[model samples]
Target: MALIDFSFYSSIYSYNHLFLTVLSFLVSALIFLASMRKSKLKRVNLPPGPAGWPIVGNLFQFARSGKPFFKYVEDLRPIYGPIFTLKMGTRTMVILSDAKLVHEALIERGSIFSTRPRENPTRNIFSCNKFTVNAAVYGPVWRSLRRNLVQNMLSSSRIKEFQHVRDKAMDTLINRLKAEAKANDGVVWVLKNARFAVFCILLAMCFGIDMDDETNEKMDQVMKLVLITLDPRIDDYLPILSPFFSKQRKRALEVRKEQIDFMVPFFEKRRKMLQNPESDKTAISFSYLDTLFDLKVEGRKSGPSNEELVSLCSEFINGGTDTTATGIEWGVAQLITNPHVQAKLYDEIKQTVGDRAVAEKDIDRMPYLRAVVKELLRKHPPTYFSLTHAVSEPTTLAGYDIPTDVNVEIYLQAIGEDPKLWRNPEKFNPERFISGGEDADITGVKGVKMMPFGVGRRICPGLGMGTVHIQLMLARMVQEFEWSAYPPNSKIDLTEKLEFTVVMKNSLKAMVKPRA
Candidate 1:
């Protein structure tokens, strides 16, 4: 009787377990089917795009094309018209290559199209879970952070206050370039020195501390590692494949830790200075970190934490560094490629400043100099695409449904080179702005003719600062030295490669000779 009772209990236990398993399976199936039904019910008239395969969509084709993603997108533009959709793994990207369409989406309906897409896992680690201004969702947090940065550091008044910072950086850059040219037989790597100079300016503005070359270089390396690790991985789009990218994820975490370790001391230093202003005589009177310390975002009780501070400062530093440096390199390349344009610019600078250094006030008086800088930007905008934007809610753009889940990106290069917008857009002509060829509205406020610095609400907050840096650096470099192509007569190869920004494939090697 005991044996029979034990057997009966064992049978009951097995039956109960089996029933629970089946029930769970059925529930999961129902949920999936319901989700499918709901998705089907939402009638979305998505923009026309190439047919894609199951799960991976057009990712495989894109990967197999062996073309830079930007070039690949450009190739698709003629086939799919101005606006088209691309299914990149599980994520949807709607690319805008037309000026009108970009203006309509980013300007006419700026509010809906201002938010950033969900960052990949690695980016999230560095972005401090979207607490940084650029990565934050379009909301009170983004507004507060952006407002604080602009008012405290990037505003016209505030930028004026940092003139000494710019002057010092410029002097350092000129001295370094001269030394580099002398050391290397008059051949200096343009991008390397330009990046260092911009980084110095941004670093001082960020922490209010002037670090030594070794320390700054170390920090710069950390920033570069963070950028490298943050590059898009397959697992970012397809979470199911994450196990395959374990090494990448691990490296990303390591880079994040390194970034935090390097940046935290700067924050602590600033914090102490804020506490006792007289304690640190070396600290600048103010810094972007100072504003961050006092910032109170809408969902936080106190100011940003140490990690968040690092993220914000990182964004501030990295944001302007690469773009400004790249711009300078491109501008210099153009001057080397077109000697007439360079001569004209030199004439303008000489007439404006008269053998002295190009000051901030002198930039406005030099129209040709401004035009040359503008033309360089129009030809080679730092990045091919603007930061990815996402809609706040499901909306319609140009009669196509734009879902909140999709990443909306503007092809800045295409817009800048649009034939419909400019006369002879392919040619790099600075006279276009002055000779009435085209009224270049770079800000895109009047119209979307050319947007090197982007347009509308979510435009780069450091736009003014970046432009000033590029213009000033170019002016001083031109005024101090006459830049020509390296190896005497070789052409300045204009082929571009995408790095942190779109940089020269053969980083500009120029023979910079000091002007007599």
Candidate 2:
């Protein structure tokens, strides 16, 4: 019995050991092959860049660089040419720095590069799986959302409709500035006021609710939470670590809950108002919310759910306010730095509008003022890379083969500052835009040189609204007051820090006095 037991145990152990050894070897071989395959794929067809490490890819490069991530991409421009690729996590990221290449891909082949990557989980949760227009994949829902937003809120005619809203908001800003000028001895923080003004305008347009400073500040904090929660987190990129890093997810959940609590009431209030036909006086006015509520797609009976509605509203407010405010701040900063430009703008506004406050309609006659806004947007675009775009299928861009389902980033700053495109690109000169006999069109349809609001099918839906907002605000400020660096000899610090937008590192604090 003992002899039989020993033989049986030995045989069983030998077979089990053999199987375990084989399995381990197979796993090692498979991993090695996968790595080799990825390495091979990277070499062939892809545009040139530093060979990012295996698995983690270029993520380590991003972490170790200790610089704004976009600047890291910019540093590679000379070495890898304008168009290059970086493998980030399991995704392939293609960066287009050449204006011609960007024009070719985003403008010429718009549809192919219009989709978004599945890279950001935080965005997915925040968006509720493509509920918002910006986060949606290229499909029917995206089309409907974009079409609805553009037709109702952002079309040229629609922008004209909201001119009164812009003027009211500008008045608030002007009055606040005047008060600050008097109270602070002519030194005022420009960005805080700019943010408040822009937020108030957008909030009013979004919900038909005029925002006082307190309400505006409250919503501003919520929107900031939205931005923070929605931003790409480390756990999002390396999902394997998500279990250990639940803080971001928890925060996102909390923010989402807060969003629902904050936004659902607005929806319900409008819904109730619409339902009650007898109370015409109390009925909600036509606004972005009303449009969203009334939206009817061809095939759908039920419109966007409350969550989707909230996300859309949040996106609308966030997109319009931050980018527009950033542009206004940059315009003011530029004007302060180059007083001649400011004086020229002031003279143009004064000649056209006189002592009367600058109006939205007046901006049309003030070409130099328009040029100033364009030049400012060109020099300091709110977003360095317009929201990341992806290809739904394999496509060729600028004579390079692009893999399917890869992320693409168009470097707006690179195109804006190209030496070939503009003379002395770094210089603050609005004249370049007008001197060429045609204004440098911000809309990329005419040309793709510098698109601050992006270009092509995915161009920001808020372009018209934002352009008008900035131009109106800038013209009014220039018309009403003189802007200068707080200290006589100090220059406006142009140092930028990237956030939801690229903002001035130290916000513009300028001395102001009413124009005599």
Across residues 317-406, which tens digit of lDDT does each residue of candidate 1 receive? 878888888888899998998999999999999998897899999998999988888888889887777777899999998899999999
Per-residue accuracy of model 2 over 1-516 as CA lDDT, tens digit each:
000000000011112334334433443445645767654545447787788655556666665655566677778889999888886656677888887787777788889888877755666777778777777888887889889988777778876777777777788898999998899899888888988888887787788654456767788888898875655544444454468557767777888899889878877766766677455463326688988876775467888788888888888888777777777788888888898999998889889988788877787899898788888878987777777788878877767788776678777788988988888889989998787643566667767788877778888777767777888888888888898887867877889876667788888889998878
Runs of candidate 1 with Cα error greater than 4 angstroms are 1-43
lDDT of 1 at 24: 31
lDDT of residue 220 for candidate 1: 90
Q: Quick one: best TM-score, which candidate? A: 1
Candidate 1's error at 88, in angstroms? Answer: 0.7
Q: lDDT of each model, Cα atoms only?
A: 0.80, 0.74
Q: Give lDDT: candidate 2, residue 469.
A: 80
TM-score of 2: 0.90
Candidate 2: stretches off by over 4 Å: 1-44, 276-284, 436-439
